[model samples]
Structures are given as structure tokens and as C-alpha cells.
Target: MVSKALIQEISQLEADFCSALSDPTRLLIIYSLADKPHNVTELTNELDIIQPTISRHLKTLRDRGLVYTVRNGSSITYHLGDKRLTQALDLLRAVMRDRLKHRASLAKETKATINA
Candidate 1:
């Protein structure tokens, strides 16, 4: 049986996971990692974010089990803890694209009505 404490723990973890993904910078970091693992310098260059900012987001992702890091001498490379995150992000992007298309269509129709 699931105890109250267990449920609360699960809820908190879920909240943490979602919270970790709530930032645009974090999402960009996840997307950048989707291609392959990268060290802080690489991520900072690709995302145009500062090294410290990337490190901060990486820490949050690591805490939430959303990313994994490997240390090689002085360089530490980060990768997605679960590759399925790319799939999730792709799905969300598809939804956003659909919504944007719908909004554009509505605007076009309104413009046509005004022009008529």
C-alpha cells in the first residue's frame, strides 16, 4: 500500500522535476544536450549563456535527475539523464506550433473580414 509519506515524497519530486524544467534557459540546455554531451564551455557557447549560468541550471537538472555529468580531468560533460526528455520536448514543440498556426489563421481571417 502507498503510505501518505510516500505520496508526499512523490509529489514533491514531481514538483521539483517540473520546476527544473520551468525555465527557458534550462529547456535550451536540455535541447542542446539532446544532440550530445557537452562541457560547460560548449553549452555556454552554443546557448549564448554565461558559464556560471549554465552551471547553475545544470546543477538544478542534476538534482532533479534530469541530467547526468561526467568528469574528464578538468572538463565535465553533461548529458540528458533520460533521452526521453527530447521526445517530450518535441511533443511540446509540436503543440506550440499548432497553436501558433491556429492563431495566425484567426488573424488572417480577421484581417480578411476587415479588408472586405
Candidate 2:
């Protein structure tokens, strides 16, 4: 059995992960990092957002232990810290596909009812 403290710790970790994903910009950052690591300037250029905004979101992700940074010369590049992030994204895609299929089925059923 898990100890109460362990459970609480796990809950807190989950909350932190969710918090990191709370912003669409953060999610986009994660997705971008999934392909390749990037410095703040690269992320800003690719995301079409401001550098400070990207840096702010990257800081949040770093605080959550979701991203890691490496210094190359004067620039710091960021990448996903946990490999599980890729798995999590895959699972999310699967769920989205399922939801879309369900919606299509429901729409078909409603159309049938209307025609009947």
C-alpha cells in the first residue's frame, strides 16, 4: 500500500503537470520541443510568439520538471525531460480520435432519427 505522504506527493506532481499544460502556449511549446530542442529565440521564431512570452512559459515548464535546458555557448536549448511526455501525447491523440469517432456516430444517429 502507498503511504499517505506518497499519495499526496503523487497528487501534487499530477497537479503540477496539469498546471504546466493549462496554457495553450505551453502545450505548443511542449509539442515543438517534442520534435527538437530549441533555445528561446528559436522557439519564439517557430511559435510566432514573443521571446519573453516563450521564456515565461519555458520557465513554468522547467519549474514543473517537464523540460530541461542545456547551454550551448551563450544560448540555452530546452527539451522534454521525461520521455513519458511523448507517450502522454500519443494517448491524448488516441482519446481525441475516439471522441471524434463518437461524435460522428452520434451525428449519424441523429440524422437517421431526423429522416425516420
Going through the candidates in the order shown, the clash numbers are 0, 0
Q: After superposition, how far is residue 102 of candidate 2 from its true place, in Å?
A: 0.7
Worst 10 residues of 2 by lDDT: 13-22
| TM match of model 2 to true structure | 0.85
lDDT for model 1 comes to: 0.90
| lDDT on C-alpha atoms for all candidate structures | 0.90, 0.91
Q: Kindly list the per-residue Cα lDDT of model 2 for residues 13-91, writing each as its tens digit.
A: 8987788877989989999999889999999999999988999999999988999999999999998888788798789
Q: Candidate 1 has which clashing residue pairs, if any?
A: none
Q: Which digits, one per residue and each the tens of the lDDT, describe model 1 over residues 1-116?
A: 99999999999978887898789999999988888899999999998989889899999999888998899899998988887888888898899999999999999999999999
Model 1 error, position 7 (Å): 6.9
Candidate 1 wrongly placed segments (more than 4 Å): 1-12
